[model samples]
Target: MAGSKIVVRFAIIVAIFMMPSLLWAGAMEIESDRMVFQHKSERAEFISNVHLKRDDFELWCDKLLAYYKNSQLDHTEAFGHVRLAQKGITGSSDKAIFDQKNNRLTLIGNAVLEQDGSRITGETIIHDMRNEKTVVQPRKGGRTHMTIESDKAAGTPLPKAAK
Candidate 1:
């Protein structure tokens, strides 16, 4: 009877350890040409066609690094030709950061974000998925442009162009 109890206890421990992975089946995985993870306790390196996938978003870049503490993902950074795509929206930049808790994504260095038929280009970009909005700001001496072409105003009065 003692042997049976030991077996049951072992099974329970195994199941408990597996529960987290099963619950977060949608956790993001990143891949790229090169990747490096440096943490206080551990470090990892990766290479070749880096790609990251989560519940709804995917990222492809040249390199990526993930930091951790006590086994929790502290933060993640991607460098060199980073591209992020999700739900028909795509963004490109030199660097990108993903903040898990705040659920925020920030793209920097000559960033361009495109969604539907609209595109925003600037030196910095911030996307707040929780609020469904994006902010783009260009660098100094740069111009921000917004163009809308529609068929509804085929004969509408138009403003004269400044010469």
Candidate 2:
């Protein structure tokens, strides 16, 4: 009766004290000007200069929605002026989805990806982070374009033999 209620209250207090330790575990750091998290819904929404960072890569967007499973980040959706930058690659798009476990990122709407000064533009682009591979597809009425740049000028000749 009364004893049971008191025991429940003590348990609740202990659980609340442990929350911070369990909040962010084994996941990237996510920051935004505003954020809302609904634990029961397993979703977190962020707006205004949304940013996500994990290791050397970074993602930025106007809005971001993150889904969680067992407190682990499952995936994320970024919308509006999405941008991603990594060591050897950079990308821009209107929208993007980052799959955490698969280490894949898919961008849509005027997607652009650049690597080693080479660029690809299309309606959609899929990048494999682990393998460093990319695929691009055109919109219904558009076409994809890829251009590679040479390091040296075409007219440049090998340097004369060193003295």
Candidate 3:
């Protein structure tokens, strides 16, 4: 009886460790060449060709570190050729940090965001998902740049001028 009880407890612990995503609430999915999870720190590290998807949002990077709080995703840091896409917008950067609790994404190092033939480039870019706001910051001695393509240039019908 005592041995059976120990076996049951071990099986439960193994199941919890094996199905880490089951603890998360959303439909977030992650894939990578290799993954390591540290239960003590509540952290998971994904290495090599990491891909993450949640709803309409998708992210790709060479490596990603995900942190959890109370069995929920707290935040994530991505490194090496970070790329993100969501809601018709695409962005790239050398590194990125996503604060899940705050619904914010910060892109660092040669950050660029593009949509509908328009592009914004800067040293750092902050996207506030909850507020639908984006702010670009320039590196020291540099300037942020943006290019807005006109509707005519994009082959869209121009609005008629009021008479």
Candidate 4:
């Protein structure tokens, strides 16, 4: 009887130690020929010429990697010729960061963001997708938009927040 009791206690201890891993299917590993992500389960992966449409914003890229934490989207990184089409504006860059939880996007590394035929080039461009505000700062002399294509738009103008 005492031996049986010891065996039962050992089984219970082992189950308790494994409970967390069984309950939360954590850190999903997604790998394809293009992109890879390590996010929790229940998240989706868009890869290999990814096209993501959130409201008015349409993003296309050679590779897109995204993650979700606690059921809320955390971040996304688009690489290798990232292009964005929204309203009358189109932007292209080597890389772009899409922070869904923060409602912002930062285009980096030789980024050219254009709207209504007007374009700006800089090392870093931070856009507040929520308020439609764009801050463009060139590495040296700052930013300049093509006069002929200037939209004179007041806001940065992002799409509706993704749920």
Give candidate 3's error at residue 133 in angstroms: 1.3
Clashes of 3: 0
C-alpha lDDT score of every prediction, in listed order: 0.65, 0.77, 0.82, 0.62
Candidate 1 local lDDT, 1-163, one digit each (tens):
2212111121222234323342221355554444334433443444446677776888887766665444445566778889989989888999998776666789989888777567788888888878877788778888655544445456476788999
- Which residue pairs overlap in candidate 1's backbone? 31-50, 31-51, 32-49, 32-50, 33-48, 33-50
**TM-score ranking of the models:** 3, 2, 1, 4
Residue-level lDDT of model 3, residues 36-93, one tens digit each, is 6788887888888788888899999999898877656689899999999999999999
Q: Model 2 scores what on Cα lDDT?
A: 0.77
How good is model 1 by TM-score?
A: 0.68
Q: Could you give candidate 4's per-residue lDDT for residues 1-163 as a string of tens digits? A: 2212111121222234333233332222222333322333523445565666665777777767665555445677788888888888888888999887678999987878776656677878889979989887677765644434424476565678989
Model 3: weakest 10-residue lDDT segment is 2-11
Candidate 4 Cα errors over 4 Å, as ranges:
1-46, 140-163
- Which lDDT value does model 2 have at 117? 83
Clash numbers, per candidate: 6, 0, 0, 4
Residue 15 lDDT in model 4?
A: 33
Residue 33 CA error for candidate 3 (Å)? 0.3
CA shift of 2, model 3, Å:
37
- Off by more than 4 A, model 2: 1-27, 153-163
Q: After superposition, how far is residue 111 of candidate 1 from its true place, in Å?
A: 0.5
